[model samples]
Target: KKRGVQTGLIRTLESALVWVFEQFPGTEAALNDLLTQESGPESLLIGKGSEAEMARALG
Candidate 1:
């Protein structure tokens, strides 16, 4: 069960990355900027609860 949860998390993260790349063109630079500014993985994970914040962050 733990392994399954880990696999699911990986898949979800992969999908989130794809979505970000597709939704926001030229995000590579923005991503670099965001990374240089923050220290946590929370900035990368786009959960349903954080949809609005994610949009704002990407913007």
Candidate 2:
């Protein structure tokens, strides 16, 4: 990063968004709104869906 800000990989979703809120307070509302507006049902489906073969195929 140009500013040397640390970056991380999002390997899993569990607690990841909560960690983001911890790192950047007061962003919860805006972030939630953005994700809601941007994500289609399929995207959210995959995110919350099982990782089994059938689930991935559905996504």
Candidate 3:
């Protein structure tokens, strides 16, 4: 049960990251820059849990 939930969460995160990369080709560099600037890779789903928020985090 717990393992299944964890697996699902991993899949969801992977999908979200992939979507981000696909939507913005330059997101990789921006994400790298964010990592250098920020403390850690906190959750990207920060605002309204929308795609816009995800894109904001990536780009």
Q: List lDDT for all candidates, in order.
A: 0.68, 0.54, 0.70
- Mind giving the per-residue lDDT tens digits that candidate 3 earns over 1-59? 24346547888998998997888799878888766765545544243457876567766
Candidate 1 structure quality by residue, lDDT tens digits, 1-59: 24346547888998998887888797766666766765555646545346667556656
Clashing residue pairs for model 1: none
lDDT of 2 by residue, 1-59 (tens): 27653355444454786786777665576545534665644564565655664233432
Question: How many angstroms is residue 25 displaced in model 2 relative to the true structure, after the best TM-score fit?
Answer: 0.8
| Model 2, C-alpha of 9: deviation from truth (Å) | 13
- The lDDT ranking, best first, is 3, 1, 2
- The 10-residue segment of model 3 with minimum total lDDT is 40-49
- Per-model TM values vs. the true structure: 0.45, 0.34, 0.49
Better of 1 and 3 by lDDT: 3
Query: Candidate 1 regions off by >4 Å?
Result: 1-5, 38-54
Best by TM-score: 3
Candidate 3 wrong stretches, greater than 4 Å: 1-5, 38-58
Report clash pairs, candidate 2.
none
Predicted model with the maximum lDDT: 3
